[model samples]
Target: MEKSLIKPFIAKRVAQEFTDGMVVNLGIGLPVLCTSFLPEGIHVTVHSELGIVGQGPAPDEANADPMHIVDAGGSPSSIVAGGAFTDSAESFGLIRGGHVDAVVLGGLEVDQEGGLANWIIPGKRMPGMGGAMDLLVGAKKVIVAMEHTAKGNPKILKKCRLPYTAINCVNMIVTEMGVMDVTPEGIVLREYNPEFTVEQIQAATEAELIISPDLKPMA
Candidate 1:
């Protein structure tokens, strides 16, 4: 598949990480796509930092509610049954209190040490981070969903040159190229994308990686 197909591919893989009865925070952008690909038979409570919970996929053109319903990115969305709305303080309270089971966030750079740099790009003036820093510190599991490289540059780096969003907080990485886990030993390659060779992925990654003994293709 082409690079344009990577985000949703990674999002689908990230969706598999959720289990039944879990409260998950899906960050803006690509992470939001996971809501549309969640596996059947599992009940997940989706949280948005903009103060909404139990959000479903983006609504169709006819069903879109312009005034009241949306995700943090301001995209039109649907709310599930029994969903509740609250203020940002309360929303972050749930996150900071560790009530969240997992958080899937987009990333610009991730280091072998599990450090993340997603907020700023140095020299560019971007809006401040909404709640990613809080989510990184408090979520039980921090998963990053991004492409393996950016403009042909490796995003999995030996060390992030951009400003750090959170240090040593990432637990797993889901990229279009594969899925990897951050282990005490090193970054362990758990699965490889069938379309790409291990050598190709290794060549694209700047960090030292250890392929798992039982490595397989991503489901």
Candidate 2:
């Protein structure tokens, strides 16, 4: 087995998918890392369901504001210039009304058919599905940033074993091994990490993966 890219790099790769001036939501965990890797020269508005938009990266310990600013994950963050705060109702209204251009979320599993499963582990109790369900259905595009597998189990499966968050909602997935796009035909391997080969990725993935005609190195 090869050393796959780390979580931060995977989040960086996913951030490249964002276009200029898009209103994007970063889900908790890996998706939140996307904030630090956003491309330069493009102004993006970052929204959190916790009721803040135009937020920046997590603040340094010394500069952190204990009272006013924090991401949905409860990590201290800085608000970008012109950022505004709102209540949770208005926050979700922005999401459910289709105002968000894109959402990068962490997934426990994603099936070949583009279904997502991340809300719970089935047997264990979860904090509850916060806003993932709303974000999945409301965003103009949904990109999943997560590890390719978990404890050697392929998270990209032919069918998800865990409870699914949404069906056919994932537009693209950026994993440590590669980047895949979900198409009407199936999951297409678009880019792969330099450390792994197409065959290696196929072997690691349980779903039938289609190598894109234009497959390229992830770097």
Candidate 3:
């Protein structure tokens, strides 16, 4: 039997980090799902580098905002309150200037040293990095939410073989199996959702883990 590809799996996990009034930017593609995970009755202002701010999840079909449109990921999105549309130049300033509280980005490979490889892999045709560079540098916090593995093998590695987007930039990682915090000391086990063990997580990881003595299941 095949396993169910959980819809909004990563989205729900990313939502745990969201708080009221967070200035957030979700990377293109999967990271955009965070929009759909917003808690009702709480206002979270989302910023899209695509010249949009105060975005909400994709509008309901019947209640769809003709003017409000979501990205390709089916995430609900809208403009920020009293926001302005500016060119990429000014937009980047918001990122690099540390105005963004947290940014959720996907990754191709992430190492224990906090290096990220999300753009291109050699011998693979992929679009080059654009805003990721600025976001890595500017965002106050960075959370990388992705599947635990790639091609039956681990993408969480001891070191990244592909070219890096940034070093020591990622702060947290949420995998199908668990959550980890990247600290100067090591990758700290924060939350593990599924019924998995530290040994299982270690077996799945390419990097060494510093399991917290007080480790617990993810909420």
lDDT of 2 by residue, 1-219 (tens): 344438888988988887899999988778877867878877689988889889877778999996888878777878888999999999999998999999999888999888999998867957778899999988989999988888888999998888989998999999989999999989999999988888889988999999999999997
lDDT of each: 0.90, 0.88, 0.79
Q: What TM-score does prediction 2 earn?
A: 0.92
Tens digit per residue, CA lDDT, model 3, 119-206: 8876775777877878898999999988888876888998998999999999999887888999898788877765777788888899
Sorted on TM-score, highest at the top, how do the candidates line up? 1, 2, 3
**In candidate 2, residue 43 scores what lDDT?**
69
* Candidates, ranked, lDDT: 1, 2, 3
Clashes of each: 0, 0, 9
Which residue pairs clash in candidate 1? none
RMSD of each: 1.7, 1.9, 3.2
Total clashing pairs in model 1: 0
Candidates 1 and 3 compared: the better one by TM-score is 1
